[model samples]
Target: MKYALKRIFMLVLTMVIVSFLTFLAFELISGDPAEAMLGTEATPERLAALREELGLNRPFLVRYASWLAGFVSGDLGVSLRYRQPVWDLIAPKLEITLCLCLASFVLITAVSIPLAIWSYRWTGTVFEAVRTAFNQLCMAVPPFFTGILMTYLFGIVLRLFVPGDFPDLHTRFGEAMVHLFFAAVCLGIPRTAMTVRMMRSTVISEMQKAYVRTAISRGNDRHAVLTRHVLKNSLTSAITFLGQTMAELIGGSVVVEQVFGIPGLGRLLVYSISTRDYPVVQTVVVILAFWVVLAGTLADLINQQVDPRLRLGGAA
Candidate 1:
């Protein structure tokens, strides 16, 4: 509880920093947004008027403070491109992106855990070698490229699903997931590979520990020792590593969404950034940052629970 509370405070602090940095970076961006939004050929009076209207003429600190205040109130201002409530523009797409990322995370976890156990069980066999090689290949390939390949094979050739035709969640929940499955595959494969490798390494390392050796000397069954002792102990590092992958998953979702033609947050972020839609971009960045930090905190809690030493105020 103490650790969780500490993490919660830190999350708030981290979010403030992220929000400030995001706002500042856009403030520093070259080119006058007001002038750019208006025609270059427009008169100076109109440009100045536009700048005042958009609050571009405000001091940097003042504008940032105001934005932060609005953020705290759950008002992210308006999208420059769409001229709509930033939240309204973001909410639906954020849901889609969250769904995609969540499905991918679940799939990766489901696949990697068993595969890791299998690899550990057959450590010296040809199966281990094959699994390692295949995972390495998957890890080497970028998600965007994999997404394209998946689209070609499944959507173009196999016709199992259309490349970018995601159905609305409300209208057809089942059909939407079906289309999302392919994109999730692209997002999950590399993560699955990474997790499997992390699990394998951690398991091997745990088996070499003094406690493990002591258990073996006591005539404990090797398989039972692995299951009852080592597996949970080894999973701490793997969980930490898996939590780190959320950043990559968010990034990959952007390119994968584009490749697969899903209108998720990633695609929205890219479009908003290209259009100099600062509110939209800032909102997305902060949301993603929050998600990553929250995931890290959850992973830490899980790790602590798995290893009592860690739970004891992280003595180890």
Candidate 2:
């Protein structure tokens, strides 16, 4: 209970710091938001009035405080570009990004674990060599590049789906999911490769430990010892690694969305940044930071539950 409370407190504090930094960074950026909105022909008087209306005329600390308060109270302000409430602009796009992330995560988990087990079970065979080479290839290629390849292969060559023709997520939910699945495959491949390597390494390490030898000496079959003991112990590290990968998937999704021309938060964020939409950009950045931090915290908590040493304040 104490640990969880401490973690929650830290989460809140971390979000506060992230939000402040996001706000400050945009404030320090070169362009004037007022000018960006109004364009070059606008008079100085118009710019001043626009700044006042957007509350950009206030002291930095005061504006930051107000923005933070609005964030906490579920009033995320209005987007200068869209002329809509920031949350309203974000909500649908958030769903699309969430769907993409979720699909990528599911793909990662589904593919990594089975392949890891297979490679571990067949340690020194031809299959293992091929699997190792495949892992290297996947890990070597970045997701964005993989996304481009997928677009060429599936979208163009095979005529599976047209590139940059994403369906309306609200109206064609099922078809939209099919399109996201392809993008998810691109986003997930490298992460799946990484997880496989980590899981395999962890399993190998666990197999070398003293308990494994003891169990084997006491007449437990090697396979029994592996399945009953080594695999379970190895999964603790895998769980933590997967959590970190989940956080990474958000960044990866941004690139994937661009390649696929999906109207997700990543696309919105890029547009917002280009247009100097401070409210939208700041909100999206802070949300991404929150997810990254929350993923780490959740991973740590799960590790504490899975490995007693973590709960006892010992090294993992």
Clashes of 1: 0
lDDT of 1 at 295: 88
Candidate 1 C-alpha lDDT tens digits along 164-282: 78789879888788778889989999889989888988888888899998888888898889888898887888788888876568877988899988889988988888887777888
Against the true structure, candidate 2 reaches a TM-score of 0.93
What's the lDDT of the predicted structure labeled candidate 1?
0.85
User: Which lDDT values do the candidates have, in the order given?
Assistant: 0.85, 0.89
- Give the lDDT of residue 262 in candidate 2: 89
Q: Which portions of model 1 show Cα errors greater than 4 Å?
A: 217-219, 314-316
Q: For residue 226, what is the lDDT in candidate 2?
A: 81
Best by lDDT: 2
